[model samples]
Target: MFRSSALLSLLLLAIGGYATPVVREPSPVKLPFAVRFNNGTNGALNIIEADRARINLIKEQGAALAEKHENVHKRASYSVSVTNEAVTYIASIGVGSPATSYDLIIDTGSSNTWVGAGKSYVKTSTSSSTGKSVSVSYGSGSFSGTEYTDTVTISSNLVITKQSIGVASRSSGFSGVDGILGIGPTVLTEGTLSGSSTTEIPTVTDNLYSQGTISTAAVGVYFAPTTVEETTNGELTFGGADTSKYTGTLSYVSLTSTSPAKYYWGINQSIKYGSTSILSSTAGIVDTGTTLIYIATDAYNKYKSATGATLDSATGLLRITTSQYNSLSNLVFTIGSKTYTLTPNAQIWPRSLNSYIGGSSSYVYLVVNDIGSNTGSGLDFIDGYTFLERFYTVYDTTNSRFGIATTAQTTATTN
Candidate 1:
């Protein structure tokens, strides 16, 4: 039932709560995430190379979606901790009654939730097969299986009943994780299910609101920069934004009208290296599935020239000298009327983990890379994990806007 997006530029959860006499306003549900680098089935740990490959696949997913025209449509106070996999965020989700917890990738790029890439699905009394086949192709990974509805548990305060999920009969590219928790737009689910070409599946967030488990259909994501290989430094807040996690007020921008980029959690932004405008106001996406900040090839070239960095053949990242690192300019992104800046220290990869990506300990590496294409592609840039680590983000589906604000680590020299 699953076909590769390469064949199609194409294609592509919930929880509940209890009652109280106090009648307090529903609080946002929170989930924690940690970062871990996948070693691949061959036991290799080249994160930079792996991330570059993933970027290509994500672009492919966007391109496929751009080719098709679609209408865009748009939580609780529970907290779950997640691990920050260096290249991906991992969260444990429980499925079925008497839930069996499975480690899943918390991805906002793709929207069809599935399992069985690693752990087998455990059917419970609440499980029901929809009799329809389901499949989704993530450029780096894919799964083809049957569609089923069951109870999905996010936290004690957050649970969704009769939520749809894919039970994978076959999968690939997802190692060390059970499957994905897609938080992207529900329209992306079109064509992912048999006999449902025009039907759009309700995402975990959508069901949460419809079921009255949360007051708002939104998710606030927070990630802090870390130097270690693995850490519990990220959280997913369902229902609404967590004010305490961010410093200033949240500023939201409407989703861009541009194609492909607009298909996901996309926005319009411009980038500057200090005072030089590298990327003009353009459309792109803010993706949790991507590891680094990627811009158009020409913009990347300008950045490389400005920073005096060379391509590191071993890691596929821009390499620079210590002196150049000290002289680096702040990479500023102007979204709407607000500006978010990445300090010079925030531009480099964590030096402590240099060896993990096949780089020398003494060499300095920049996290910015080329998107492998030019600016007019619609999806000309990707503000990935590196950028997310410095800001608080809100995917406000109910309002059809993306929100960003300063965080405690916005100017941290952690890297």
Candidate 2:
């Protein structure tokens, strides 16, 4: 009787195998994002101040990481929606079995996915504590909490099972958002969790690829210039690039070998204000978290002089007259033999939303700012979203390279 039952079980297993055919690989996913403005401590809007603070924190973090010995260590067809919060890009992600959607900042600077800054995390059947504590400081804000692994639902087609997430018990600096969805290099996750200093946490992109949700371990980012304070003008594509979003072929550049900058999605690039060079080829990073473009202090001084732009005390950005604006030269960036230009209109902040950043709508403000430090810092320039809005970017981890291409908005005079 035991032998007969075993034969029957084997037969049923064979039948089940035949019944379920091979599952097809997932396709690239695209996530739409919007723009929002977070009010300051005084209940007024001041994006420049907030952005500068964040930049300072990022520089400090990079420098500290460099001091420490380096030990650290998807493609789908569907896309998730994200928001461009004037200063920060946000995405709504669902967690747990009975998913509770939380608004998270889409950051390419850090790699520790967490929640519970603005909304408390809700535990469900799929939530399990990892018995480890996690904490991260973002210069302007921070959070400390217990680590938990749960089902993270980025979208219907982009779900990740047993993903590690920090449930913040205490957090500050993120008043409007719940937490950050870190999509930077996995190495950035090192030392953020307790009990294991060397163990790096897998980011959302990591899990998505490992779990067979996407074929490639890459993310393509597209951002349209925003003239309003709030609008959906960005997209995050997982697994692969959306070829339709870009024009011409995508140019690739290997990650920089320089330290600190190498710790993130670092690259080598030079800046030229029209025919004149400002910042020579230097190691830096491409960050989605930053609101404006930042170059070395020396480079900024040169740019200021060339554009005839004066620092505006009111907005803390370079102010130019209509005549200067008309004569404003294209800010050209050369990365990996490819030249990307930010036209005069693209260099200035959105005139329509000038008041939102505490600037007079009548006056023009340039988006390029000083990095507070000169070159040779290993991390000299930061091509922020302002630069990205005009190009299509691909963060290809499997290739250890970054890709860029011109887009329809590359020369748009929208701003």
Candidate 3:
């Protein structure tokens, strides 16, 4: 079972909780090896060097544009704090005046940091969500906030120069989440907030780069999951890769528009535990947003029966017998010519419930924790953490395929 509320609170503020004090540079931690993946069809592996070069190209482009304004490629890490169930701001972004902290989510799956608002939402022009009063909801809940354009600063590191951010009244039900910080390329863009009305908005990336915070057009993000542990064991370094966070090499799987973003490797024909095949499916999404691996019903049942675990309805989590949990061998998923093996913790997640049950075959609900008590579709799933922990995913949406590589692999140039 998991810890109590005290532990949970501590965990939230541990790594991903409060934005840490801003650092002047990306973490110098170097992982054990380079991360890359096979293209899945020809058995050609796409290493990190070339892909990194491309990503670097984009960063350089951003930086070049920034140099014209005497901008420096300054990046830092800041702690995000939730006060009174609401996030408070500490850094100041200098717009036409001083920029105040607003609520925001630091997301890697997304590429932009935007606030919800429009021209009419704010009485002042220095709002991320200005003139824009909208009700936005996530898988978590809903919040009402205005969007305005302002400068957002983290630890003296400028985020957006004149970016749009969402400013909400203390009454919004965000339950502590401030704004959405997207790290994906296309996912980040300027837009209008929608509710009863709409208004124009700018992304933090656009705002910051346009201003003089960092010289690069793109910013990097380092994030650790919100768990009940306060270890600096996890971090996402923007503009550079930190090598020490993981033991093995980094692997990659591409992201696509499909359900489970595509990987460089093909659908794992089937997963294997020694000689037995566990589950076979052609769909899976490599999401940085999720923390667990969700397998379909067929896969979930196979794992349950083979692992001899039981499902608890109260918590909607699966529990394997202590002996069963420890005795399980490594499980592997074969995608094209590549095979991914997972550790025990990667397969079986810790539960927070004391007791209750059905058989283990029913506990595959992936989203909303235990949100699948009465639904059938929820039983088949996998969260992103389990897989990402085992493999470095290379998302190549441009080519319609993703890549997967073992932690021992390194990124190399193809040509």
Candidate 4:
């Protein structure tokens, strides 16, 4: 299992780079009830509640933000099932009832959300451990499950109605997750299955948008600490877009052929340490499911060189000068044309394990960790925690393409 500390600290993702990154300022909108969550030992994200002025600012900017990205489509919304004890979202399918859901890693890095099937057969065969080898081959992880499809359903008061769905490939850890949810615009449906024979392996985001499982076409996600008791961790809004719950600004990032799905969002334009700009125009992805922000090789090198520390490249993770990281000012991102900035403390990531020479153990040292390439076919461009929690965001898909908006959250919106 991926450790909480490891998962929370860095933006570990695949690499894909094409265009130059943009830089800008953050939306003036502020969310009600400051999002309070522990960042483990390093520190917690001390997000304060937004003031009345900020709220008014968001209202003023809402329309222009909405009108900015009129071409982006709202991807698919998914049904999350609790098969085992774990939570996973649905991916895509191959043949037969491809609608059946499988355990997936809800990743914002990769635009495509896919599932694993051990030596696959008909829809009714028992799931075997054959996927263990497959997992090891891909990322040294495997899946376990049994072939079983059941009537699945998900609903939200903000959504159209109770949404019905299907589930298959019941597994222990693999199927435990409702299936991975990729919070990007491009659905991973384009490229033909490269190494595998799976044909229905569309980008999870694409399939969800293409399918009518969720009413509104677009979706929204709000995550709190595991301690906060709630039936749903976040909301995936469908059909209509709600401004009451978001800051109401939909920033965008241009996509390239290498971009996952047909198009991709979540690209970061810049990052800063104090007044010093480290990554002037770097590419990145915006993933809510990811706890930490991941950076590319060049950016990581520049940051580490400036800070005078060596970061490991294997895992795109980081542990900078704890005090410097905590004290830094706004960490910025420039999407398509708009720029969004987060307070400095938000960039402080916890070092899960004690640092040691490379091993599989979580006990790693503290230093700026360098990730893989973000140049080609990478999720490194997606933005994560540093950006989302501060604003009330909406995925507006009603007009084919989608854009984000800063919303005004009066009450805790439930999923």
User: For residues 1-415, what per-residue lDDT tens digits would candidate 4 score against the true structure?
Assistant: 2212111100112123446432221121111111223221123221111111111221222222223334333222222222121112232223222234333444343333324333233442322222211111111122323222222212111111111112224323232233333444443222213344233233323333344333334454444322231122333343333343455455533442222222344333566654677666644444443334446566666666665443435333443454544444555555556655554433433232122112223323222233344433223344444345445344443444335544332112221
Q: What does each candidate score in C-alpha RMSD?
A: 8.4, 10.5, 15.8, 15.3
Candidate with top lDDT is 2
**Which ranges of candidate 4 are over 4 A from the true structure?**
1-151, 156-216, 224-233, 252-268, 305-327, 350-369, 374-380, 385-387, 391-402, 405-415
Q: Give lDDT for model 2.
A: 0.80
Model 2, 58: alpha-carbon shift in Å?
A: 1.9
The sequence of per-residue lDDT tens digits that candidate 1 reaches over residues 1-415 is 1111100000003233455332226554445466766553244355555556556665655555555555322101112122222376777789999998888887888787888989999999999999999998665667899999999987767788999999999987786789988888988898899985668899988887777666678888888898977777887777777778899789999999987787789899999999999999999999888888999999999999999999999888899989889899999999999999999988999898788777888789999999878999787899998899999999988989999999999999988
lDDT of 4: 0.34
List TM-scores for all candidates, in order.
0.88, 0.89, 0.54, 0.49
C-alpha RMSD in Å of predicted model 4 compared with the true structure: 15.3
For candidate 3, write residues 188-214 as lDDT tens digits: 221226542213234454443334332
Worst 10 residues of 3 by lDDT: 3-12
lDDT of 2 by residue, 1-415 (tens): 0000000000001112445753444454444455566666455466566666666666666665665665421111212122222377777789998899888888888899999998899999999998999998775678899999999988766788999999999987786788989999998888899987678999998887776666667888888887866667777778777777899999999999997789889999999999999999999999887878999999999999999989999878999988889999888999999899999999988888777777886789999999877999788998988899899998988789999999999999898
Q: The CA-based lDDT of model 3 is what? A: 0.36
TM-score of 1: 0.88
Off by over 4 Å in 3: 1-99, 102-104, 109-130, 169-173, 184-192, 195-233, 244-249, 257-275, 334-337, 350-382, 386-415
For candidate 4, report its TM-score: 0.49
Which window of 10 residues has the lowest lDDT sum in candidate 2? 1-10
